[model samples]
Target: MTKRQKRMAAVLLLLAGLSVAAVLGFTAFSKNMMYFQTPSDIAGGKLPEGARIRLGGLVEKGSVQRGEGLVVNFSVADCDANLPVRYEGILPDLFREGQGVVAMGHMDGKTFVADEVLAKHDENYMPPELAEKLTTPDGKHSCAQFKSMGGST
Candidate 1:
C-alpha cells in the first residue's frame, strides 16, 4: 500500500481502539454508581423495591425504639415526609434523635431494612448530604444564622 494509505489506516485503528476503551470505561462506571435519596423521595415511590440505595435524612424525634434483640427501629425524615427503618446491629455512637443520618440498605415493602447506618459527626456540623439542602447560594446555613445571639441579660 502507498505510504499515505498506510498512515490513514493506522489513524483509523487508533480511533477505533479509543472508542472501545471509552465504552468499556463507561459500562464499568455505570454499574458502580449508587444513588442517594431522601425519605420523601422514597415515600413518593421513586425507588423500586429490592434496589440497593442510600437513604439520607434527619432521624425523627421520639421514633427510636429498641427491641429485645439487636434489632432497632427508627424513623428518618426529610421535613416533608418520614420513612420507617429497621436495622439489626450496634448503633453508631453519634446516632441520636433529631440528627442527620444516611442508611444504606434495601426496601422491604414500606420499611427500609438498613444494613448500615451513618450518623452525623458533630453538633455544629451537618451531614454533607443534608447540609447541601440547608445551605443558601452564598454557602451558609439559613437557619443557623437566625440562632440567638449572646447578649447581657
Candidate 2:
C-alpha cells in the first residue's frame, strides 16, 4: 500500500479499537452499577427491570419475622409506601425495627429478595442515600416521617 493509504488504514484501525474499548467499558460499568431507591419509589414502579438495586428506608416495626433456618422477612418503609424484603442469612448486628437500612438485591415480584442487608451502626448514623431521601424540610433526618405515613416505629 502507498504510505498515505497505510497511515489512513492505521488511523481507522485505531478508531475501531477505541470504539470497541468504549463499548466494553460502558457495558461493564452498567452491569456493576446498583441504584438506590426508597419504598415509595418502588411502589411507583421506578425500579429498573431485572437490575440489582439498593432499597433504603426505615425498618418497619413489627415486621421482622424469622422463618425456618436463617431466612428472615421484614418490611422497609418510606413516607408513601412499604416494601417487603426477604433475606436468607445472618443479619447485621445493628439491624432492627425503626432503624435506617439499605438492602441490596433485586425485586422478586412484589417483594425485595435481599442478598445483603446493612443497618445503621449507631443512633446518629444513617446511610447517606437514605438520609438524603428522608431529610425533612427543615433539613433534619427523621424516621418519624415514615411513622406518620402509616409506617411502624
Candidate 3:
C-alpha cells in the first residue's frame, strides 16, 4: 500500500479502537453506578427506569405482605409519600414494618423492584438519611407524629 493509504488506515483503526473502549467504559460505569433518593423524590417523578437506585424511607405500617415463600411486598414512605417495593429472596432479620430501610433497585412505574434490601442493625442505629427525613425541624423525632416503628428514635 502507498504511504498515504497506510497512514489513513492506521488512523481509522485507532478511532475504531477508541470507540470500542468508550462503549465498554460506559457500560461498566453504568453497571456500577447507583443513585439514592427518598420516597418523596421518587413520588415526584424523579426516577429513571434502567439505573439501579436506592430508595430510603421507613417501611410503611400495614403495608407488608407475603405472597409466596420468598416474595415479599411492602411500601416505603417518607411520612408524606409512599412508594411500593417488591423484593424476592430471603429478607434480613431486621426487616419489618415501621423500620428504616434502603432498597436498591429500579422503578417500574409506581413500584420499585428491589434486588437488595438493607435494614438497620438495631433499634439504636438508623440510616442517617431516614433519620434526617423522619425527624422534625427541631432536631428531634416527633414521638406523637413520627415515632419509630422499631428503628432508633
Candidate 4:
C-alpha cells in the first residue's frame, strides 16, 4: 500500500479503538449510576422495579416505629406524598422526625428497604433536591404546606 493509504488505515484503526472505549465507558457509567427520587415520585410508581435509588424527603412526624434490634420504620414525605421505609441499622445522631433525610435503598413490594440512611446534619440544611420539592412559592420551607400535602403534622 502507498504511504498515504497506510496513514489512512492507521487513522481508521485509531478511530475504531476510541469509539469502542467510549462505548464501554458509557456502559459502565450507566450501570453504576444511582438516581435520586422523592417520595412523590415513588408514590406515583415512577421507580423501576428493584433499581437502587436515593430517596430524599422529610421524615414525617409521628411515623417512626422501632422494631427489634436496630430495625426502624418511618415514612419519608414530600409536599404531595409519603413513602414508607424500613431500615435495619444504627441511625445517624442527627436523624429524627421532621428532618430531611436521604435513604439509599430499593423497593421491597410496597415498602422501601433502606441499606443506608443519611439525615441532615443541621436544622437549617436540606438537600438541594428535597428543598426544591418542598420549597413554597414564597421561597420558604413550608411545613404547613407539607402537612396539607398529606404529610403528618
Displacement of the residue 62 alpha carbon in candidate 3, Å: 0.9
Q: What is candidate 2's lDDT per residue for 34-79, written digit by digit as tens?
A: 3456776667664567788888788887888999999999988876
lDDT of each: 0.73, 0.75, 0.71, 0.75
Ranking by TM-score: 4, 2, 1, 3
The deviation in Å at residue 92 for candidate 1 is 1.1
Clashing pairs in 2: none
Q: Candidate 4 residues 6-67, lDDT tens each?
A: 99999999999999999999866752443456776667555569998888777888889999
Supply the global lDDT for candidate 3. 0.71
- TM-score of decoy 3: 0.56
Error of 1 at 42 (Å): 0.8
Model 3 is weakest, by summed lDDT over 10 consecutive residues, at: 144-153
Poorly placed runs, candidate 4 (over 4 Å)? 1-35, 121-153
- Which 10-residue span in candidate 2 carries the lowest summed lDDT? 144-153
Candidate 3 local lDDT, 1-153, one digit each (tens): 999999999999999999999999977674234345666666655344666788777787788999888899998876666789999978888787777777889988678999999884334567899977775442123112332222211
Q: Candidate 2: list runs displaced more than 4 Å.
A: 1-35, 121-141, 144-153
Candidate 1 on 33-90: residue-level lDDT in tens? Answer: 4345666566665556699988877777788999879999998776466789999998
- What is the lDDT, from 0 to 100, of the residue 6 in candidate 3? 100
